[model samples]
Target: MDVRDEAVTIPASEVLLPADLLVPAEPVGAVLFAHGSGSSRHSPRNVAVAHQLNRAGFGTVLVDLLTPAEDEVDAVTAELRFDIGLLADRLAGIVDWLATERPFGTTPVGLFGASTGAAAALVAAARRPDLVQAVVSRGGRPDLAGSALAQVRAATLLLVGGLDEQVITLNEQALDQLTSRAELRVIPGATHLFEEPGTLDQVAEAAADWFHDHLHPQPASA
Candidate 1:
């Protein structure tokens, strides 16, 4: 099961975002990851989840959502990361890029988002319903997606930490607005980051299973 790892620059929303892409041989599907606020493509949590997906034969894309200059500004104001519309626009562009790119052009695509990135992922899914097949949110702020929540057509899975009560309530509200196939699963003993022992692994496994179950399987090659 050879996996090709590439350090690439993706053109999204008129910006070039650095990303890490991993494609396993005969991948069943491909998933794009949107990191939370103050996080990059190098986020350890997302990287761990990507590796889990890779082992499950799913290609993964982890791209930085903001440019260097914007990141600098965001670091100071901490506002850009909370700008759901801007993030969604870039995420939607990345989805467009993935749809037309080589190897993944025809692949079933899914999205994995954490924290505020989850809202962007949801908004992007609503904007590109035909291209996106499934979505998973890890301790995310899906409520920030607003009215777009009702427009999402992808199979959505919301994973929240059991101890994160506020987010859980928000997710529940958003869950009711989702018209597509959706489910909410609370990870026991997990907090916002799932930093507890074995908690992150649970997130990884659940995400892999959801993507596997929802993303259309690739045809067997001769």
Candidate 2:
């Protein structure tokens, strides 16, 4: 695909977050992406979604929720990514940093999270309602979010694969705790990873549209 944005790096709480900063030549808004368990800024799936969002004229940030050393340990034991509190706090710090940063300062922030990262993203958005405008989750473990569910004020979309029965049920269980405008979507013929052909792209497109529709300049365009 053709390049449409610049990549940048920033310091998170404990780590230097490597990010793929996608800026639409003529940007509309911005979203930060949180990958699933054991994934990083280099995840092809998240990168795919970022590409779609960039094409839709939205800026995107795909960054590491953990530091390099932490990620190395987490990648093997899958322990670091499970700490929702720590991850969410890191995400919140990143948002604050962006608020003070350049181009990102002018854009509304949204979050796109998958799997366990979805919970972290939700918690982060909940903690900083003044920053995040909207949120989207793909095959997420919202139930893992615990009480953070009720803290989220941003409009949220939870997308699950049709065959991801367990995760779907978990999301349903988690929905009752949410106080925000939230919806659950099931993509047909998809598995946990949504690796069935174009299903992943479908997910990416859906997320981009959701963020675009829900996130906008504050005070509404009246």
Candidate 3:
């Protein structure tokens, strides 16, 4: 089936966030992507993953959590990027927006986050347990979510690069705190960016499988 793409603008905490949305003729679920520091909906790496998800029949929304004005200040201060509370609030707002939008409102929703965005995703999941069905983090900093880590109810997948040992340890610690179903998988020979040959592909495949398994279970017919 052919995939349909659309440009959308979602309101988040008084900012208008630009996003790119893709949906198959019949989608199993929807995944909202929260990019890492210094990245946006235009990120090539995330766009690749979104394509994979779309092929798997999962609609995807790649959103910019920051407005153009905020992005500029964040680029200079590098502070907003790490503000997990602010990021999480914005993500929760987007999730709420998705729940009220057409077509997308009925579909199960998941989250795919990278870098510090992972922490924000976790926090948002904790806040909106009714809306977020699953979550996947790529080379992320889930540890930064703090005490809220235990509150996330979504099935979560944490993908890390084996070569990134420090982050691996942090992910392990975060995994321990998570009360929900969670698993950690490390890709060998990859760095923090998963820039090694075929590494990002592994991350995408793992994420797709996880979302497919957990997001939208078939309902029994009457």
User: In candidate 3, which residue pairs clash?
Assistant: none
RMSD, one per candidate, in order: 2.4, 2.3, 1.9
lDDT ranking, high to low = 1, 3, 2
Better of 2 and 3 by TM-score: 3
The segments of candidate 2 whose C-alpha lies over 4 angstroms from its true place after superposition are: 1-4, 219-222
| Local accuracy by lDDT, each model | 0.94, 0.86, 0.92
**Which should have the higher TM-score, number 1 or number 2?**
1
Query: Model 1: residues >4 Å from true position, as ranges?
Result: 217-222
Candidate 3 on 129-159: residue-level lDDT in tens?
9889899999999999999999999999999
lDDT of 3 at 72: 96
Per-residue lDDT, model 2, residue 213, is: 87
Ranking of all predicted structures according to TM-score, beginning with the best and ending with the worst: 1, 3, 2
What shift in Å separates residue 221 of candidate 1 from its native position after superposition? 18
TM-score for candidate 1: 0.96
lDDT of 1: 0.94
